[model samples]
Target chain A: MALRNAVAQAAVSVRYVVQRFSLALLVAAAIGVMLIGKADTVLLERARAAALDLAAPLLEALSRPVATINRLIADVEDLANLRAENARLREENARLVTWQSVARRMEVENAELRGLLNFKEGPQATFITARVVGDSGSAFVRSMLLNVGRSGGVTSGQAVVTGEGLIGRITEVGESWARVLLLSDLSFRLPVLVERSREPAILTGDNSQLPRLAMTQSLAGIQVGDRIVTSGHGGSFPVGIPVGVVSSVGEGGVRVKPLGDVLRVEFVRVVDYGITGLVTGPAPPPEVYGPPAPPPRAAATKAR
Target chain B: MGDFLQQLDRWLYAALPGTLVAFLILLTLAPVRLPEVLAVAPLLPLMAVYHFCLFRAEALPAWLLFGLGILFDLLQGGPGTPVGVSALQFLLVRQAILGNQKYLVEVSFTFIWFGYAVLSAVAVALSWCAVSLLMWRFIDPQPAVFQYVVSLFLYPIFGWLIGRGRGRDPLNAPDPRVPGSRP
Candidate 1:
């Protein structure tokens, strides 16, 4: 009996030891994952992709009712504003009649000018529209998962936009889903031009409501309401895609409010410009950028 | 056969807490597009961890918390935090709570909630510090502060639901908050 008691007691001790060991080992494994995250290895990317593929269907199913409810709410709000909207639309329609003839005349003039210059057109951008199944960002990221992926011919670093303007770009793709890193994410940096002033600047997200302008020659050159567009400097994003308008300029920083309401956007277009150049930005945050991040900003700063 | 069926029933009951917490984790990742909803969604799974740690430690173990945290990071599609950051934070928070589990369990409901409010602040601050360190830049503190507020505000609902479940579980000890209750 004593022998049996000793054996049982020993068994319990061993089990306790094993449980403690396993807990410590799992904690170590988690830290190892964080350390290796920046490496952005193929194995890591594949693991993330596999996980994304598994979750996409579940997210897609869950988002449907949410989207429907949102539309219902928006419809109610629209109804509330209908009378005011109708009066405003009528006034806008009368003003648009004056601009319609001017636009037609400019189109003819633009065609003649292009013919005289013998200018070839830029590459036609082909795109696939994807439903945003999840805005998966928590505290650290500002990214959304899309319903299109490898099977849909979606590739990494493609520009994602809505009809209103640029929103962000695809940073990762799985078998049937992709993650777009949003313009308001801290990791996002884009080469953009002030459409009116033509002064070049970099738009960098600080995880705020609006992203700030960086690397501009002069903040004085940028003013409130000046349009921001992709500069096509690195040949990744297509030239002249509207991004946002300068919404503020002061001691706080120059900020651009994205034209598209990226947070609430239901669908986004992933456009393939047929150019596979590096994603435009240096030291692009993390492996989210498919290409290995280049070393610090020395070369990019000099080039600018 | 009766004994075997009883054993199976007991096993299934033991699994319920983890399963419920897992579902809550998945719910947070769902694409709820209400304005500011995603930005300020309460950290639901963490609430589950806190509850289970105090009352039903056998059901949601430390290793389970580690796994759920990693899953949260993956679902978040983390930029600076693809993995491990949250897992480490959960383990740290779990350790802190479990170390004080005896006194915490013996306290009144209000006292328990106060303990949670304090611990959760530390928990959120730990994650903010950890992710900021990983990024090598200080991230905005605004979202984290908002998340903490919503989480605290919603705690009573979450705790009441889970507390009722704890009372119903035959394997669990009596609720300390119940007057005349004894361990």
Candidate 2:
């Protein structure tokens, strides 16, 4: 009986030691993975895409009920404020009607000027509509997964927009799913220009409601309520796409309130302007070195 | 017949933990939006790890915790950000909880809640630090704060669900699998 007890205790000890050792190894491996991921290996990208492809269908099915519930809630809220909304819409519609004539006149004048200047037309953009099936839901990253992918011609770097305004751009695409890096993500940056001044600047996201403007040559003429639009410097996005309006210029710096309501985005249009080729082309091959020199001329010609 | 019955019992026991892990994965993937409340949803998997650590540590082994964290990191962090942050965070939380298992047993629900609060705060802080170091910039802390508050409020609901699955009050019963523990 004492021998059996000793054997049991030994087994338990071994098991405990094994568990602790394995845990330590796992922690080390996790850190190693984080380090390697910073290099952005092709294997990691493919694995992420594959995982997203597998999870997309399940996420779509799971999100349907959520979408339905959200729609129901929105409908109920609309009904509750129907009369006030109707009055507001009527006033806005009347104002829009007056502006319509002015916009028509400007459009005609703009076309005439373009023709006189012999301005070249840009590539016509096509769009693919997609539903948002999931979000990262982490505080560190601002991204959402859409139920569309390469199969739908949604490629990386395509501009994503709602009917309201610019939402973000596609950063990763799987077989049947894509991830949109939102304008509110900390790493997001884009070239933007103020409409009134046409002064160019960088719009940078800091995981906040309002993204800040940076790298402007001068903030002298920039002011609150100025419209911000894509300057299209990198050729990844088309020019003149409305992004947001300057919301505030405080101690925190100038902030732009995005026109698209990212929190309520159910569907978005992935716009392909046919300019991705300029940004992502095949890399040039490394220059091949000639064959190595003959080893040291056999070491003894002079002595011989 | 005896061997078959024993095998079936083993499978059933494994299924309980497997299902919980699968559920946690699905919750992470689900896009349940509550715009008025938060921009980012609460961390459901963190709550699951916390609950199992207190009530069913054997169900959640260290390796499994590590695997779940790795999966989360892969899905959560894109190419722009460093991965494995969540995995390391989860592993540390699991280790800390398991190491304190002795003192944790027989503790009141309030004390357990407080413990979870501290664990979650640590997890959030770790993630923030990891991300800031990786990006070389300090990220906004508002979303992390919101996630912490939301997860804390949502914990009791998950705890109740876990308790129901055990078919007993987790607070009242000591886990039988834990050696030298009493019910």
Candidate 2's DockQ:
0.47
Specify the poorest-scoring 10-residue window by lDDT in model 1 chain A. A280-289
DockQ of all candidate complexes: 0.45, 0.47
User: In model 2, what lDDT does residue B153 have?
Assistant: 88
TM-score of chain B of 1: 0.85
Which pairs, if any, clash in model 2? none
Model 1 DockQ class: acceptable
Q: Cα miss at B69, model 2 (Å)?
A: 1.0
Error of 2 at A63 (Å): 2.2
Model 2 RMSD in Å is 8.0
Expressed as tens digits, the lDDT of each residue in B47-141 for candidate 1 is 88888777777787778878778777777874655577778767766777777766774788788788778888887887788788878898998
TM-score, predicted candidate 1 vs. hidden true structure: 0.84
The lDDT per prediction is 0.81, 0.82
> Relative to the unseen true structure, what is the C-alpha lDDT of residue B144 in candidate 1, on a scale of 0 to 100?
82
Which residue runs does candidate 1 get wrong by more than 4 Å?
Answer: A1-15, A20-25, A39-43, A73-101, A280-304, B1-9, B163-167, B170-183
